[model samples]
Target: MYYLPKELFFPSVSLAHSSGIIALGGDLSPERLQLAYKSGIFPWFEDGEPITWWSPNPRMVLFLDELIVSKSMRNILNRNVLKVTFNQNFRDVISNCQEVKREGQNGTWITNDMIEAYCKLHELGIAKSVEVWQDEELVGGLYGVDLGHVFCGESMFSLVSNASKVAFIALVEKLRTENYKLLDCQVYNSHLESLGCREIDREEFIEILKVEKVDS
Candidate 1:
């Protein structure tokens, strides 16, 4: 649990300390935040709490071509009850994610500062949102950053039952259409597992990331 300076570049921090938490107590500036994601690091903190950076050890990710679409999920896909759109409503999606309360999680880590930071990322065309629309209203959505062919999924929320699932399927379809190579899920969870996310070592993730074309 060490602190990092705002002026530090991508090379300043070491990946070997992904578990030790190389940074803590820093402002979520657009440049710092952008650089953080590019280096596979992210911030997570509660309301009124210090900005805490983290890079988990055993990361969760899914190769776009390797998603395990179960038979049941395939049936859900066939129904096509909902339609999906990219960057349709980023503000709404993030707000929803922040408001949707879970039983155990202490309040939301998606604080006001977090919102503004991701909004800045969205403005730069780095962070994106995928909204699931049913008829005329938004039911579910997810947001993340698009780095080259990889989509680093951040958060998702559902207003209606099964809406999140719809959004996810739509996201995969969009990724396929766009020829995406992977979706970095950050961490593992049963919910993501249901949606076909799997685990890959952090080293492996860095290896794949290293080969990506750097944005000019």
Candidate 2:
């Protein structure tokens, strides 16, 4: 139960305390944010309270080459019904993700400060987005930080059935082509597992990430 220092990061594997609470009371400044992601920790706090950093015990990740694209999903992908793009209309993508409703939650966890902080990370070339559009309308998308050779996925949303899946598939395929070794899902859910994300121990994650050099 220690507060996160200004622009300082605790050990990713340590995680520091119960509730996966790595640290508390840090500004969402760009430098601190970038350092946090690079160390495999990220900020996750609701509005009004100081930013809380976390690095869970079991880290969720995916190896791009190992992604399981089911025959059914491959067929859906082959259809190419949805158009995907990168870094285009980030604000819309993030806003939509924030507004999307999840089970047992009335609203989003992506606060205004969180949005702006990630936007700054985007401007700095660390954060990236994938957008799905149909007939010039935003239907779904995802965003995250490209830390080292790993992509730390933050959030995703879909307006139409399978739209988010489409966007995610497109992004994963692109990462594979780009030679990115890993995709950090951060947390796990049925949807992510269905998309091929899996949980790895913190030490395993840190080891793999350490071997990966953060591309400038």
Task: State the C-alpha lDDT per candidate.
Answer: 0.78, 0.83
Q: What's model 2's lDDT at 162?
A: 84
lDDT of 2 by residue, 1-216 (tens): 767665455655474565667878878888888877777788887877777888886888988876777798778778887889999988889988899897788766799988998899889888899999889999999999987477889998988888888878888888877777789998888888987889988778878777865443
Task: Name the candidate that leads on TM-score.
Answer: 2
- For candidate 2, the lDDT comes to 0.83
RMSD of each: 2.6, 2.1
Return the TM-score for each candidate structure.
0.89, 0.93
